[model samples]
Target: MYKTQDIAVVILNWNGIELLKQFLPKVLEHSGDAHIYVADNASTDDSVNFVSKNFSTVKIIQNSQNGGYAEGYNDALQVVDEPLLCLLNSDIEVTENWLFAIIEAFNSEENTAIIQPKILDFKNKTTFEYAGAAGGFIDKYGYPYCRGRIFDTIEEDKGQYNDIIDIFWASGACFFIKNNVFNQLKGFDASYFAHMEEIDLCWRAFNANYKTKYVGFSTVYHVGGATLSNTSAKKTYLNFRNSLFTLVKNTDSKVFIRTVFRMILDGIAALRFLIQLKPKYFLAILKAHASFYKNLATIISARKEFPKRGNYAETDSIVWSYFIKKRTKF
Candidate 1:
């Protein structure tokens, strides 16, 4: 059985010194015996010095450069020998006893390789965070939505999703996975850089016959979009482009058809952005498609590296279900 000390909660930091100062103490106090680490992504700020000076017990792993989220954790985690690895965000405030439920699930569910805790918004407290509200699920087109969140509609937490369940993907905001599985999967695709990379890793895990779960008993409050704001066009570009990368690389069969259909839906979304007068977002979509085409060959070759599996999506179309049917709540 796995114990609390076997878990390593590693927060990926990119110059968020204030976040560390505010939240790290709570983590150190609440986490029983689990090892704590601050994986610095070569920040130019005084974050390392701040952690070193005040948080002596918290270990720091400095990377050579700021490789964003994907490569940053991939590098820092190389030396992390803990049995279970929790890839936490710096802007998250973890609740008391958050590691207990996760460790219990890992001990009980031998086949489960990855897990996510219930993530609420720090600002609102009662509202589900946009990143990974309860757990994550994707449509057939690879559009991700959570049980408590669909598109832009977010639900208030009322103990509705406070149960352990199988999930399609866990949020990167507070993702937990087995170290062996992470190494076997070769970590997140560095090409993703950030955004939707967790989905890609979970999809790869699912294809390999490993289970990804959500332990609702464990909870954390995330200040969503702390590193990159939602309104940023660059975030939009990475999300759109990396999602396509995941679809092409891992979607079971009918890759071409799925890609085309998804792109058509994306075009409609782009048009909607245009109608909304968000020209930057529309152009981001265009740039995303252009980048997709540019890297299609490389992505296609990546498909041969993994064995694809069927029945990857929870629904046929989250877009239709949310927009047309108006089924916002999971």
Candidate 2:
């Protein structure tokens, strides 16, 4: 197969030696002149040593400290000189066509800056994964929902969502993006740490006058959250806090005010967590708001550089209720 584009695939790993072994082989097998790079976020495990031995073709960078997800990805972005770059998670595995599919999407449009493939779960291939299943969409209120998911619900893949379409954002777990647009946006916002940085980046792309797409033609299986386990309270806090962080950063003044009002209403929902004795989750919500308020000046300054809403309702691109769609191979 002819290499259509030089792609830099950067996978962030932390103590995931087994997953590194499993996914790296498939990546190296089909990458086809694509430069593969792995950034270890200071793994205490033997992950770095293992890569150094077997994957001679791979470039491994062992960070001196465990910078959060955004920092690690920005670190990887520095060394990427290829026209196309993939921000991949360590837990994802792909077929030979994964790179090919994402590359073709970029060719479909001049303004396309980001693309995501059809993402399936590793255990059950038909089911959709958390981050990207088809592609991601968001409601008007800054709540992100994907074609495979709405709210907390994840729909069955069933070969649906195969149509080519524009999306608000794609999953960061395995994002295929353009290198120049990535650097132009200054990469992801470092303040986001782990969550919502991808969404924030896409919003910035819109501000900079580019488009993000979900390429249903290509596919990969995501094992989901291999770097950090889901049980961590830190993940919970960061996800909620960054949701609010992105809202303030991207939305117009009216939308931001509406979101703030809705968040106050949603505060009553946090009572369920407290009633269930999830004090940490309750505290997470509080800390999320506290963190946002504390950094108001900085957030405003950064957000002020972006353009406001462009005369379209944010909900126009999203469908919340039913998601079964006609499939196409193109």
Candidate 3:
């Protein structure tokens, strides 16, 4: 039953060993002969030791620092001889045919670099996961939305979306991409540290003109917030900062003027902290802008590498490009 195919599944683990205990066994049961690597981001808990003792077949990489999500996954994965590599989160439970579905979809494309599975929320079961429902899309101005989410509203899965389609980005929680393309993009930007790093990587894919697909036939349950809670100050900072990074790095010259205007509108989103009386949100805006200004050179470097940009939009009605209303922060 062991078809000698090279596939490596890289799971980024923090202090969430209990969650991994529930999910890792299921992943191994379905992984076939794929190499499994769990990279622990220096959890103070005995997470790495636990993996080392219990799962002897799976390799473990322990980091020296709590390098957050992006750094741990991208850096700890030493190298990949595998044709395909999946960067998975520890908080997700996958179905038996999950990896098979993604591999099949990738086989259908010659230049496909990334494949994202249909993601369902573990607690809700019927709702789409927060990262992205099926796949992500970039607006004319570089803001991202998904089939499952737009602004702050996450839709119910309803078994309604199962069609494979090209996407601007995939949710990072459970994503597969080719090894060469991953290396070419230099993987996730470590500066992002966590939130939206996948989108930034996909924006780089767009800049490189590689294809990304959402494999709807495969599904996984994500516990969501295993790393950072939406209401946490840290998540706000990373999300805001990475949003600016992805935008400045991917926008085309043709839309540069309109993109700058969109940045102003997006900046107004920080009003969530000001009008709603949340000091953390205000601090988020401050740090995000400061980081953007500080990394202006790197941002410009990425823009210079962008060969071309596509003209794509989902329209306001279909994409639900509405602003968020009075909603409790996750």
Backbone clash count for every predicted candidate, in the order shown: 0, 0, 0
* lDDT per model vs. reference: 0.94, 0.78, 0.78
lDDT at residue 277 of model 1 (Cα atoms): 99
lDDT of 3 by residue, 1-330 (tens): 112267888898888889778999988888888899888888888788888899888888878887787888777766556778888889888888677777777777687888899989999989888787878887666667788776667888776788899988899988887878888788778888888889888877877878889989999998888777877887888777787787777766655675566657646767756888987788887888888889988887867765756565444222223643443211
Q: What's the C-alpha lDDT at position 327 in model 2?
A: 21
lDDT of 2 by residue, 1-330 (tens): 224447888888888899998999999887788889899888899999999999998998777777778988887678768888888888888887677777777776788988888888887888888776777766566767777766556778776787778887888988878888898888999888898899898888877778888878788899876655566667778877887778778877676665676577447646777998998888888888789889888988888877866532345323233333422111
Candidate 1: give its CA RMSD in angstroms.
Answer: 0.7
Query: Which lDDT tens digits does candidate 1 get at residues 56-115?
Result: 889999999999999999999999999899999999999889999998898897999999
Q: What is the alpha-carbon lDDT of model 1 when measured against the actual structure?
A: 0.94
What is the C-alpha RMSD, rounded to one decimal, of candidate 2? 3.9
**lDDT for model 2:** 0.78
The reply for model 3, stretches above 4 Å from the true place, is: 1-4, 315-320, 324-330
Candidate with top TM-score is: 1
